[model samples]
Each structure stands twice: as C-alpha cells, then as structure tokens.
Target: MPTARAIDTSDRHPIRAFLDLRWGGPTIMLDGRAIDAAALPGFVALDADGAIAGLITLLDDALQSEIVTLDAVQAQAGLGTHLLELAAERARALGLGRLLTRTTNDNLDALRFYQLRGFRLHRLAAGAIDLEREADPAIPLLGRHGIPLHDEISLIRVLGAD
Candidate 1:
C-alpha cells in the first residue's frame, strides 16, 4: 500500500520522533549516543503519500548502521524490506564491512525480521537493558509484545554480497 522514497531534509523532526519512539522516549543518549541531527548521514523510507514510515541511521565512521526504527503501518506491505535494501546499498557504497544493530530479547518480530534478511547473531549485551533502566527508569521493562525485556541482542550482516 506504500512505496518507499528517500527522506527529505525537512523531515528531520519526524526522524527524531521515530528514534525516540523506538528508544522508549526522548532522553539523553548515554555514552556515545547519536541521533538524527547528530548522525551525519541517515536515510528514511517514505510511504506513497510521502509520510515517514521507516528509517535507518549510519554512523559516519561507516563500520555500522542502526535501524534506528522501522515501522510500516501496513504489515503486509514491503516497506521495511525496501528500507533495508536501501540501507544495505548505502552501507556497501560506503565500503563498510558490515552493518550492526541491536534489539531487545523480547523483540521477537525484530529478531525474525533481521534474521530473515540475512543478519546473524553476533553478541548479546548481557546487561545493556538493565543499564538502560538505570538511565531511564521509565523505560519499559516489558516490550511491545508483552515479553519481558532483558538484554540486547546484537546482530550483523556483512555488506558485501559474499
């Protein structure tokens, strides 16, 4: 129902909102934290009507990229996959070896989504979720699907088609 398009410069606010929504809420990024305005080169996928639907952010260093947040109002649509392909293209163009991302143990859908797209298990931040709670007690202990959020699972996909 929606087609993907590049994110516009004026769309920065919505992109930030997507990050905040995914991260639980607007709060300071702990440690080496970077968001839209701070993230030097980012991409977003717009729906047919030109609304922000999904986004991917890549740190300038180019070694890694964060999905940041990707949401498709219509589940049956292929918007997510399109955004992912765009991200991969950008990563390849940047000559990055691979792209890395993290999702909570409770995000079963994300686990499947990334895995299905060729991302593989790399590492699990054993206490990152707890550290997050320490930073923001308001961060939900439970995930969108009601599963208890415990740890962050790191996943990676080599940028080269090899």
Candidate 2:
C-alpha cells in the first residue's frame, strides 16, 4: 500500500485544483455564513502511490475551531481517523483548546464516527442547510441512506486535557 503524507499547499494552485475537484470550492458553509477552506490551513493525506487519499479542511473562528470537510478516497482504512486526529492536533497546537465540527442530520455515519473519536454532540441547528444552500446550490437535497440533508449536528472535542 502507498503511504500517506501531508499535502504541501504552500504552492497553492495544485492544492486548490485538487480541492475544487473534491469539493465545489475552497469555500464552505457553517452557521449561515460562507467560509473558505482553502483560505485556512488543512491536512491532505497522499496514498502510497502519491495519490490524494484523504483530506480535512479547517476553520478557526472567534468562538471555536471547525472542521470544514473530511474525506477519504478509501474507506475502513483509518484514513478518516488519521486526518481528524491531525486536524485536532493542529487546533491544539494553535491553542484553540477545542475542535468542533458539523455534519448534516442525514449523515449517520458521520455522527457515529465523530462520537467514536471523542467528539460530543453539541447542538442541532435546524434548517441550517437551507441557509447553506442559498449560498451554494450544490448542497445536495438528499444524502446517504435516503435522508434529507437539512439540519446540522454540531459536535465538539475538548483539547489540552487527558
């Protein structure tokens, strides 16, 4: 298997191209506002063949840190976990003290995954996707398991402690 390494986005263009392909853009929506994932720092995992296997984008606002996106090309390989851990580690390094993320209510897999990684359910932002879609129509109306992509489930992980 090919090893995964952090992507060097310092060069900018290549990373942007890759991100644009995976996500609609470097910009993402959170709590009714538009935020650019490429504008901030993130971690991308390169597979053994030097292909993009997984990535996690982040945003640090005045209140807390948010994981904009997390994707793995291959599943059940600990790729998601590794990327998440790296994002959390970076948050702690920045003295943020906590890492937060949001997933659609339809995404049961994401809910389970984040909880398994020590993130607690924070809140549910009902109809949040409506606002998000206004800015970006690409936000699918329905997601996996036939669930309607509507509400936003907030999850948080505390840092700087055992």
- Tell me how far the alpha carbon of residue 79 in candidate 2 is from the true structure, in angstroms, after superposition: 1.2
Report the C-alpha lDDT of model 2 over 1-162, residue by residue, as the tens digit.
234444465625655766789876766766666676666667777766656677777788665678888888777789899888887777777778788998889888889999999999999989888778777787789888998888889999987653
TM accuracy, model 1: 0.81
Cα lDDT tens digits, model 1, 88-130, are: 8877877777877778899888899989999999998876787
Clashing pairs in 1: none
Ten contiguous residues minimizing lDDT sum, candidate 1: 25-34
The local distance difference test score of each candidate is 0.68, 0.78
Residue 65 in candidate 2 has what lDDT? 74
Please report how far candidate 1 places residue 12 from its true position, in Å.
1.1
